[model samples]
Target: MSATAQALRLWRRAEEDDAWRLLRADNAPFAVAVLAEHLGGDDRRVDADELAEAIDADLDEMRSYGHDLPLNARGYLTAWRTAGLIARRASEGARGETYELTVDALAALRFLDERESPRHAATASRLASLSMQLTQLAIDTDPQAARRLERLRSERDRINAQIASIERGDADDALTGPRALERLRELLSQASEVPDDFSRVRAVFEELSSTLRAKILESDATQRAVLDDVFRGVDLIGDSDAGRSFSAFSSLVLDPALGSAFEEDIRQVLERDFARELTVTQRRRLRGFLDELKIRTAEVHDVITVFARGLRRYVQSQDYQRDRVLRTKLLSAMATAHAAAQTTKPYTPVGIDLELTSVASSSVGALRLHDPSEYDAAADITTHETAAVDWEMLRAFARETEIDFSELTANVNDVLTASELPSVGDILDAHPATQGVASVVGLLSLASEYGTRGDEVEQLTWITPDGIPSSALVSTHRFTERIP
Candidate 1:
């Protein structure tokens, strides 16, 4: 492509990409500060409400410092979510939803983080790490067994020499001062990218799954091959580039030996004298690096698993067929409309009237501002002398509310003596509900625990304390004997 063509493509991408859009936003600095303060550290996700409250407080603080933030936390969050900088999802067993930074937003945050403290392009620790990886890759990939054996022998000899020197107390602590810090920074820099990688992998899987669904809904002919492959247990997603890469990464993360060694090395590094020079955040991050990697890796693994299963379920349930039909009808309608537009203006009145679906929308200016004073109660209280406790009145009140279980048990037993497996209605008929519905309710409660209930319902009638007749259809319960 020509330079102009390439530049146009780059411009288009920048316009579409969320990370670029976030960076180019008017309040980019404000958004970045809030996001990093709340969710940029150990917390990958925060409760939606909690994040809004936290951001609201920060907004107040920033506004006090002469920042031009007019909107509240919820307003900013809504905008950011709509713009795809932040994502919200329902978490399991949580009271409300949670918000997390999307992969693109993470990328934006990472860009800003690096800009503040840029990594050297060719630092000694970075170069040495790269060199060691390249050497290992070359040795491992060597076609000739003899060459691989020779490389392994050389590595073993070097290790032996190092051991001999260490045994003779001639080895020096070269990684003590500045060198240790450099390597630590390099490690931290690399570790910082892992979370973004996991997020990217999850995003790729989601997009892939969506693409597969779209393909499935294209047409019957297109779906046949896809359905056949799916039915035959072909792991289309797990076999994909992103899926395979994540699987390998997860395996490494889950490896017991690798995890143990990584943890031990981190501990030893943190205990070193050079670690004292590191900031508290850096030290904390280093200590939890392995744990954080495992968590992120597992999250990616879960996303892949969930998406794969959902895709399979989507296919098996034949939901795509309905979607395909809907799509076809929509296209047909659109085609008809397009043809009609050629003959008549859109505003031209026609004999046929179409009802379109719509949502309720209103102007923000129409909303009424809440006045707390309007709802506040400001009545003064008047003190009165305490009345003497009336024991008889209290007992009468308790009798009215409390269920008379003994009377209900006796009624059940009396009814049972006359007939075996007497239903609740039979017992109520024998004892005319002296306590009205309360007595009936007491009997039903006892029957539920000590007797059997049937699907059949019977209308039981009773007179209330005010002599008003009342009736209700309740499930039939039979008692075989007197309540114990």
Candidate 2:
């Protein structure tokens, strides 16, 4: 299935079972559920164009957050958005699709994760109460009141962290990422007596939340104004003001006189720094994907370079070992997988070993010494397989073209008119560089057919020059628009 469609399928699966209810409560869960609701059924069969647009918009939204929002606030928003539960809507005119709250989004609110579903409703209500209490604390001004406010704000953070952990899987590193306040709360509550771990957890959360909250509230109007802009798209605009005076705010909030000195000097300061760097949720994770792509590209390139060096050394040394060769090959394959990601895998080696014929996993074996035909066929197979990989690489390179040509859009459009083969010129028209580029486009079309779950996006055409074909050149775009 296409990414959107597959996501839609996942959402439906969750919703039909009443699981989607938990998603709408937060941004990440909302994104995932939103995708499902927007593209459910026929939508799960979203066209390539829509997928392209959704991804672009998501990236754009994230960029805005990073440049404008405070690091701490941005981190929280990112968690909420990347949960991938929000429904994406296709915007009219120049705009593409956007995330809109939907039925599935509501389901996200009722999120009953595999473990947290039972407490979903109860936890949500408690969270609301804690949020209110923190607000009250923020307004209070007495010296004793400041300490109590810090305690309450820390509690509120713990609750928010717990909700976050439930929406995202445990692999999300909720403990390190967001202070694991909620988990720590449960940990403290469950213990018979106050253990070192429990005390440590509370101390850590209290310092982290209070320190960050104070910095944020004390932030100058310029910073606060930027903060307001960061959360402009999101509805949660907590008391914001331009040119707001915050000098009255005590620096002691972060560098305190009353709180734990050791905790303040070492842990609290470090914790504040970490919290500030945390990425918040945006309307989409499009920017995250782009950053990931850049990182992944760098990693893949390094691996490939290492492989080339290894191959050169091994070939020169003539110290041939099957295990070593296979290991190199495996690393090379993994590099390709990382680079292409969803693209068709380049090669599936079938290693043969005479001694270990019983082994299902292929091993190294020389060709039958006397069979010429078998040798020729095997050589042809190797050539074919090798050629396919090169083609895929070229396609990937070309696709990193001037624009991120949406695979989703291409997949949705290409196969609408099956049996009508696009001409050489027609294919070339979409991309006009060289024969190599043309070949890549062809492979891309064919790849989309196999990669996508359904045949709607798969198109095949027949072009007979002298014999006189029906349609001279029907581009994939035209194919999608055609009523026939």
Candidate 3:
């Protein structure tokens, strides 16, 4: 079938499908309301039992409204799945199955629940969007250099006019409160729609995969030819309209600087006076919508990765060889059957049953125990008694070696008060080393704390407690005298 015809058929199916019809049913509003209340938040999927309980609770309140509600939540979900309003898939591990709204279904529900903006329409935002779309379309579709040049010239003229207006003090043309609110609403709406688009793109990719698999299994072509066709089909999918849009969306979402800028802009908007008009829920929704888009983008990428891996495995496995063998066996059997039919009075079809068994059994092996005595060993050891400490000798050693930091600090401070900017040498000259190198280190520490002068280096010579001379290079410092 032609691409146009296929698209038309799909559109017609969407319009006339039982799922679409279900949306028009009286109970649909209630069903959609329940879904929106229970599943419309951050959750992409809900457990069947949890969804049932939620539905039952909603039905309890809804019963007072004299409306009949479907208590069988699972049945309702199955119906919706059959209609393409939602999808049911086996949950991971042992969590049974889960149901999530399909792209079309979500769009439908969002449209139904959409309300008119309380703020005035933003002409600037609308015009800007239209202008951007037109410019992009022109650039993409028109390859003529003359047309491109003309577009550039026109854009320049528009920019010049805006600049002139600004210079003329026509700042009144700036966005007003209502218009800003409208623009904010527009941005929120666009962001909210991104997740649905990702869901649609994922669906398209999955459909493409299914088509490729079917072709591989049914085609009479050689394995190489089939593999080539599969690759070409995959490329075609990646270049499709949905694929291109999703790729662009992913790039935008993943760009750190752009994401940060967008978040900052949203924060700025939220702090505006007009933002007070928005309810807390609305504010949170606007703020969180971008994060949700990022999550959806990640999910789409994950799906693509999984699909690529599965496709790679399918190609590498070379199942076509087994398929050929099976075909040959079937042909041989048919020929044998024909020969037997010619000789026998009557021929009857016989069934064969094959029993398959695992190569390994599920029995556990015996555990081995180690003897403690084999690992345990005792070795001869020498022991020393605790030595008695000489308290007087330790006191003498500490008194001879101990450097007083407080006395060093007082001496350094005295030198700084006497000199406008003192070097390490000057501090040493003012106070001769009593503790030797240790006192020099204390002076350097004090100079560092006082702040260094402009690239001035100083050499300091000090004697150790044992009378050995040591020299060190230190940055000269300018110290301001502390006020009383």
- lDDT: which candidate is best? 1
Error of 2 at 221 (Å): 41
Task: Write model 2 residue lDDT over 117-171, tens digit each, in one string.
Answer: 3433445435655787776766564468778777778978998988888787754
**What's model 2's TM-score?**
0.17
lDDT of 1: 0.83
lDDT of 2: 0.40
Please give the ranking of all candidate structures by TM-score, highest first, separated by commas.
1, 3, 2
Better of 2 and 3 by TM-score: 3
In model 3, pairs of residues that clash are none
Instruction: List per-candidate RMSD values in Å.
Output: 16.1, 27.7, 25.2
- Which TM-score value belongs to model 1? 0.70
lDDT of each: 0.83, 0.40, 0.71
Specify the highest-TM-score model's number.
1
Q: List the residue pairs that clash in candidate 1.
A: none
lDDT (tens digit, per residue) of candidate 3 on 149-237: 89888889999999998999985676658878767767766766666677778889899777766666656633444455443234544
Lowest-sum lDDT 10-residue window in model 3? 228-237
List candidate 1 segments past 4 Å from native.
233-235, 351-484
Better of 1 and 3 by lDDT: 1
User: Predictions ranked by lDDT, top down?
Assistant: 1, 3, 2
Please provide TM-scores, in order, for all candidate models, with all chains considered together: 0.70, 0.17, 0.57
Cα deviation in Å at residue 28, candidate 2? Answer: 19
